[model samples]
Target chain A: MSTRWYPIYQRGNPQLRVFLPNFWMKLVRPTEEQPPNVVTFAVSTEMTKHDVKNYLEKIYKVPVVEVRTRIALGDTKRDQTYGYITKNDDVKIAYVTMPKTEAFKFPDLFEKKAEQLEKDEKSMDDSKEGFRKFLERNKKRPGTPGWFSI
Target chain B: MSSTLMKCLSLANTLRTATLRSLLTSQQKPTLAPWGAVVPALASHVQAVSGIHTSAASLGLMEFFDDPKVWSENEVKVGRAWKPDELRIKSNKELHQLWYILLKERNMLLTMEHECNDKMEVFPNPERIDKVKISMENLETVVRERNKAYHLLETGETGERPQRLVHNCFGLRYMYKSCEHVLPPFMNIKWIKSRNVGFGGRAVRKFLLQYREKLYNEKRKAKNRSRNEVMMILRRNPDFDLEVLRRQFPQVNIDKLRNEDKARGHYVPKIGV
Candidate 1:
């Protein structure tokens, strides 16, 4: 089957199998709180519930019990200065129901980001101090290369 | 008596050699055990130790997420994209597997980027998505090359979708990609009518004329602009290198422009001083 030109399916024909499917599904964090079994995904707008089911089951090896999908319209906003309106692209969101045995939670990736920033700032301050010391030491010898001293 | 003893020894040696040959053959071609299970023979052993080619799928849903180690990093360092030259050497199976790998990486990056945008946080290393996209494009190109070569060898034609240059009703030529239809061209009335459109109408001819004139005007204006620019440069700098000006604007005749009044500097010439 030609992937670029997908022909209409007719009865009594060979079942179509996509050998190299290029569909992409992004596992999105749900805006609203959902059950542990139901994992939300932002998929390609062209994908149906069946495609999402097959994608998760065959590709990710996830046992999907039920799949529900909906296209959420993006919000439109007007520019404050120009008053021109712009709208975001509508996205197909899929809620995949997994077996009760499987449990997952959206991870807090940036929980430690605050501490990381503090550490980075401390290191930056130390580097500033070191540079100031180096400049003071080189006061007597103007236009000397940094490597010539140390 | 000694000859008989030697004959017995030769028979024993042949028997031993025959048994060794049978064992070597069995090791070479692995046999299936009960219930279609492969016997862990030499060939299977080598396959088992050959190392993992694809990523392990045990990560499950976590596969959609980036590695935990780089979750909160400010900048994630990564290698450059897979060049077409690098992808060309890979086997079809390897390229197919790499395509899925890159696809998954792109999905993961997009997921992270979406989450970051939702939370109003910075997504580290956003260019990683572009890298994966480039790799995927290169992979597709390599796969297409192989497919084209195979099709040409077997069918004496590129097995790609057929397209032809056709003129539309607007008198514009474009490549029309043919699509699969149940009815033949002679039978399909709608398609026939659509394809029967000819280009030479009074309005279309006028449009074509104006379009050509517009294109010619653009070209003419560009040449005139460059000529004027060269003249201005010569006027500002009288001793400017003529060879350099000639190289800069190859289309402009530097010698001819030098003789023009516009190319002369404002300063008076010291003649016969």
Candidate 2:
């Protein structure tokens, strides 16, 4: 069943069926190269392997062959001044194997963003240069109004 | 073709309404029916309810959006959020039906918001999401209240998580909520080991003493600083409202301080008979 709260089960408890499962699974790019059917997801830490499998199969209607999950320890860094170490919360990474018939490739969201970034940088530089020129022009005529210039 | 779309739209609306009602009314227990078996029945019910509004060129669930006439309009008028009293008056079945309708409405709003964010355009009526969230929260609160009352009546304990104030290893006080476990406390070696590791050490005692001293020092300095500030203010502005100063700095004894030399102004005082 889903991660929703339910009554405790007795010895011969019937299978619990979750009506509305609220778990969200985001498809993420795998760091290392893997088989075509093997996909990775950064799921909620509380999610179990079965939950991930059911989530993909039921919600997204994707055929899941097998599911593996691991809680990866987050990076810990020591502060330069304080010397105290800070650690990020561990994340549950799910490696799901889909049916061979279906294949998924993580699409690059930032592919078109590179050109936009270049244009933004160019505009920023132009503005900075313009401001510098304005400052130079007013340097010789301190307190003199800009309207007084030719 | 148009009629089919309208039918689907209506079905979704009905389901959404039903879900919302179920979420709101805690008194009504959900009939434990296998979802796979009841899917067809639920679908048919949705279709039956949607058939009522089929005359208007059968639009899909998305058809619940603002009319094409108002698409370009800057603003759209809408009613306020559904009050708890109004929802409470509705029958359980009606509420259940309404819940599904609201859920669909919420999903539609989220879809629209996502599309707007992607296009870098302003989403019309952003408050719609807030209204839906508020309604959902209120419904959950109502359900929780009913659940708590039921549990209190049936059992001595509340059906919520049990919590208690506890001092951690750092000697800091915090609320620790107890939860269910497969193993008993004695059997749970990991939990027992962790609990054993928590608190009681010479280093911890030293740290707690320093921490408390630091806190006390801050409080004492603050009080002394305020007292000095009041004295200075009285010395400069002798005619200042003593009542207001005393009220503002409760820690400072303004009445006794008022008779001090520092509180007396530089101006000559007239002798009293």
Candidate 3:
């Protein structure tokens, strides 16, 4: 509670410092094609354009050429059973621009996912084959433990 | 000098309300890093700012996105929360840094959760959010404990936001947390008006009467339930210790209730000294 408390900022009084900022910003994949230097972000609703600019420039150490922000309205849907309307929380999307020379593409997070699945499948098949062989060897002595023989 | 004056003018001209938050650049500048570390100048370039030396390779602004390695994993394993005792040993600066780290982690989790929900996919290891929240809460408690100890030692006060019990319009007592105000008590017309709420009219009297009646009803029912329980206990065991019953239910008068019809057992009392 004390952490959230901020002193009133007067002209001559010392400025209030936020030691822990509760605001969050997420780097979202751009829906449309744009310059490689421009990264789109979905940020906390309370965050301002200056906060986005400073957040990248300070915490993330990313050079920010400019920042543009807008609040996107959440989608509303009617319940299937009750026909009651519900809406998602509105989000603030920030478009942060870096220098022309710097480039960032939202890396395909699931690029190696297919390869991982194949590896897991191979391991599963190996385990299955081993279990089948163990069952075949233990057919005559059903009560015997695998460790007792191997 | 002219450029700075022009910059200040442009800052003043913008009425976005959020940019005004940056006006406290002086106060927020040093907090991003430790005292001896590189101080982020208000006009400095991004390359000059190195908030954490250990995380040099960790890209900024991308912290909110999910780690690429975990994109295909069905679950993410995480450790337990930082206990209060563990946090108690950490230095204030370390705790402050931990707070930022937890804050960022929480943000990352929230972003992932939102994206997962949007995509109609389950967010993996939801407990990670709870763990981070617990750690943050514990850290804050530890900090508060230290602050209280320090304040008690130095200022003879808790050094917390002062609060006082006050009566509301419904004649209910509540603890009102006081906040810092630019104006004094006398100058705050709205606060003064709110403080002098009129709870004296017949309507307020009726409301208070009904409220008190509701509270009295709850107390009366509780008293009745305890009395009946004591009666049942006495009826079940005639030789039951009175002292034990007295200690258990102080509100119920044991001696008087012992002679009541409800306390009398179905069978005649056996002859005993």
Query: In CAPRI terms, where does candidate 3 land?
Result: acceptable
Candidate 3: deviation at residue B179, Å? 2.5
User: By lDDT, who's the top model here?
Assistant: 1
Candidate 3 lDDT, B114-165, residue by residue in tens:
6676556667788878977898889888887887888899999988888999
Model 2 C-alpha lDDT per residue in residues A63-127, reported as the tens digit of each score: 78999999989999999999999998787888988888766665433344456557657978999
Interface RMSD in angstroms for candidate 2: 9.6
The stretch of ten residues in a row with the least summed lDDT in candidate 1 chain A is: A1-10
Provide the TM-score for each candidate, comma-separated: 0.78, 0.51, 0.71
Q: After TM-score superposition, what is the CA distance of residue A22 in candidate 3 from its true location, in Å?
A: 2.1
Docking class of 2: incorrect
Candidate 3: residue B199 Cα off by (Å):
1.9
The lDDT ranking, best first, is: 1, 3, 2
Residue A62 Cα positional deviation in candidate 3, in Å, after optimal superposition = 1.8
The local lDDT score (0 to 100) that residue B107 gets in candidate 3 is: 72
RMSD versus native structure for model 1:
14.1
Per-residue lDDT of model 2, residues B47-128, tens digit only: 2111111112223322224344334333333334556765666554555545554544454455455445655655667786
* lDDT scores of the candidates, listed in order: 0.75, 0.62, 0.73
Deviation of model 3 at B184, angstroms = 2.9
Q: Stretches of candidate 3 above 4 Å error?
A: A31-34, A74-87, A111-150, B1-57, B229-273
